[model samples]
Target: MAAYEIKFRDARELAEALKALGADMRSLPFFDNRREIRSVYITDVDVRAANVIKQEMLSRGGDAAVHAHAVDCGVTESDVILFGTVKQISFLADKLETMPWWGFPDTVKVLREALASFSKKPATIDLPSGSSLAFGGRTLLMSIINLSDDSFHSESRTYGNVDVAVARAVEHAKDGADILDLGAESTRPGAARISESEEIGRIMPVIREIRKILPLMPISVDTTREKVAKTALEAGADIINDISGLTFEPGIARAVADHNAMLVIMHMRGTPETMGSMCIYSNLLKEINDFFDEKIRTAISSGVDRAKIILDPGVGFAKDYSQNLFLLRHLESFRIHSKPILIGASRKGSVGKATDSPDTAGRLEGTLAVSALCAWAGVDIIRVHDTKENKKAVMMAEAIRNADYA
Candidate 1:
């Protein structure tokens, strides 16, 4: 086991400080505002040395407690001390560097430096179903059930009827969908926005009916409005899947936090109405990363828990053909945030562009191909229209990932 101590003047500085310390910037856990403490991790071999280091800190006018493990380090124990302040922590790091037992001096040095320059509050989220999905591990599946008549993919769009949608939801559950994402509006580029009443009318009934049978399966409402999310949660929805990433609607984050519902914060530069025009990025990957960082911070400030938050790369949302391809190829870059990643590239315009399939239904193979790629890259979730096929692809990819370990 490894032990670590996180000491910060405040929680806001912890994230930036951790980044400076060379802690995997992307994998840092979300910190609650009230818990504004730093973590110092030490391995079992370093435990004795760590205790000596703690004693040194106490002697140097710093108060620290020993806990068995560090929260972010993924270690489980209670043998390490929780340091009280940053001033005492700063001197403690300096003292440890001079000690022989501080073998990983560089790691220690980076952590100390990170503490000095830390800023930015971490994001946190909570979900209705009582299960929290965080970053890391195999991708999570967000099965697509479009209720619009003119969805980019014909195979996905239902006739906005309750029977069809409920049957589809049951099928998706049988096909191994981790979550059923129900959407009434079509977000295809150039698609017109529907009225709020119409959108709710089309989706609420379907959600209500599905909850009757698959009551325990988490359901994510795909909308950018606070009303839609609020209504959905009231109708038994478990998560909010926002393609606008909570930027489109006012007070949406509060609704999510208020309901303790998980929120899928997707990355898209503009509204679906004009997103095609905003598909340019000087550095697509970096820009997406920065976008997520900002959104994650915003979500946290709004009271969403870090554990219940999921990230979507927004594959075809605002990206052009080439840029969309680039995002899919480099999806692994999102691991920096250490939150579960949900990639929605199923039978979108990008797949149609790649396969020259003018019809959305004709792109199922292409969608499955990308789904396989996402699974291979260790994505946490692959949002798709074809549940069975994508599930098969994920299982196959998992076999490959487990081959060496097995």
Candidate 2:
């Protein structure tokens, strides 16, 4: 007799393994729901809802973890942790929909949406250029093109050099970059802010030249100013990568919507000048999740399409050394948002600190390590400096992760 345990990351992989073994196709979905267990953390749940969740989970052969006082209605509100398989959670959601007390109905809707988001494969993002970028199959790379002399990485700076920036963009496209991101203003901590006109001057020529050279290459303009974003889009940019998460100028969201361009909303607590001092967080993951919840709602309300949005956790922005590592390690937690995730950890201070290499030349290995980590976490896009090396790292990570199960 042989005893063994089969390893699979998610329901899709489990289904694939079953199908390979010639299991009945019709039974796949049933087994899919039963194979993986999910732990969902819901906050500010009312005591009544907590009790109901506990009872419903228990009925479904699952469980809910709440404050001990929750059972006696000793607390008005408490966080709830649900432990269940997809099938069990689905059943609980259905049962909650019929309950009218204590916002149970609303909880049901959000809970089900979260479950769906967690289980969903990557989605396709439609670009205004009448093209589409698909996610989930492989990690996408966004090459860096810094148009400011003040950018943190000295090698990436091409200020006042349109030809140089365009050449780098062309090289990145050749190096397997899925997107090219051009930044005119330096957003590093304590970095000086530049005028919108100055920013436009730095980026427009490069963008126009890139459009002329690589017309099919997707361009992402990294800026927090609405005018710059609008100007870049008008001059052939396909996406606006806002590090402010739509807070610096919420109007940028509307501009993205007006142009039908894609938006990369990144999380940053304060302006670059002040962000270094604002790294405090009561609960790192929960606070970030809440921040995204609010920012996403703001973007959607400002007329941005949900499908055209991407979420970035802002690894080095408003994050301390340790917090940066924490965010990278928990990238999968952000999957509940259901939007494609973009991580820009390339050549950042954290990478320097991690590998004890303070220079960009020595940090390439650390950056590639981050690239591999992001790929393993199912990240949709990685904004990086070393395009070719990071591309290889992502490919190797994906290859190992998706190796055939025998």
Candidate 3:
């Protein structure tokens, strides 16, 4: 007899494994409910709520981990980490809905929303051009086209020549890039902010030329200024990738809404000039989640449709080397927002640190490693410098990820 182990990512995969064992189709759902376990973190939860949650989960054949001081009320609030199968958690949420004290009912609502969001990924993202960006089946690649003279990757800088920028865009398109991101200003450490006119001068010509060349290819402008986003969208850009997460220039969200364009809200702590000094976090993942929650609310309040928004964890912006690594590993946690997650870990300092490659040019292998991991983690869009190579990595990783489906 052979005794070993099997692994599955979600209920569908679990069902497939059971079906291969000749299990009854109707019983698959029943097995699916109890086969997989999940963990969810909720911070600053009221101690009263924590106790009730613990009791309910235990009563349902699951458990929760609370602060050491939670049981005796030594702490006013406690951080709760819940552990349970899908069936147990769903049953717990249903029971919590009947309790009217300490916002248990509201907690249940949030829990249900999160559970639903994480389980079901968005299949397609509608774009402004009456087209859609498909997801779920495979990973998408966004090629970076830098128009700054002082870009970290010196070889990629095309500040003065529009022809060079256009050529790079064409090459990226031919290299299987699903989206092209053009950034005029450098956001590297200690990089000075350029005037609006200078920024526009660098990218406007390139945007117009790219629009003329690849009329159907989606163009994204990486900027934090309202006027720049408005100009780019008017001149043929379809998405705005804001590193500041709409905090730097809230008006940029309005520009996106008015143009009916997509927005990529990235989480960052400070400006490029000061972000290096702001790499402090008590709880990295929770802080980022809170940041996304607020920025998402801000974008929606400014009239941007929820479907047109994407979330990026800002891998290199304000994160230190270790934090960047941790962020990449837990990209799936961001799925709770129910937005397509975009990762741009291409040749960043973290990649250099990981591979012991001090030079940007030598970090291709590390970048490809990160790309494969992101693809397996179900990242929707991977912004990369080497489009063709990373496309291959993403495709191969995706094949392995869905190998069970075959």
Weakest lDDT window of 10 consecutive positions for candidate 3: 121-130
Sliding window of 10 residues with minimal summed lDDT for model 2: 122-131
Q: Pick the candidate with the highest TM-score.
A: 3
lDDT of each: 0.74, 0.89, 0.89
Q: What is the per-residue lDDT of model 3 for residues 219-270, given as tens digits with 9 covering 90 to 100?
A: 8999999999999989889999999999899999999999889999999988
Q: Regarding lDDT, does 1 or 3 come out ahead?
A: 3
TM-score of each: 0.69, 0.95, 0.97
**Predicted candidate 2 versus true structure: per-residue lDDT over 284-351, tens digit per residue:** 88898888989999889989998888999999999999999999988878988888999999989999
Q: TM-score ranking from best to worst?
A: 3, 2, 1
The residue ranges of model 3 lying beyond 4 angstroms of the native Cα positions read none
The Cα error of candidate 1 at residue 6, in Å, is 37
User: What global local distance difference test value does model 3 have?
Assistant: 0.89
The TM-score measured for candidate 1 stands at: 0.69
TM-score of 2: 0.95
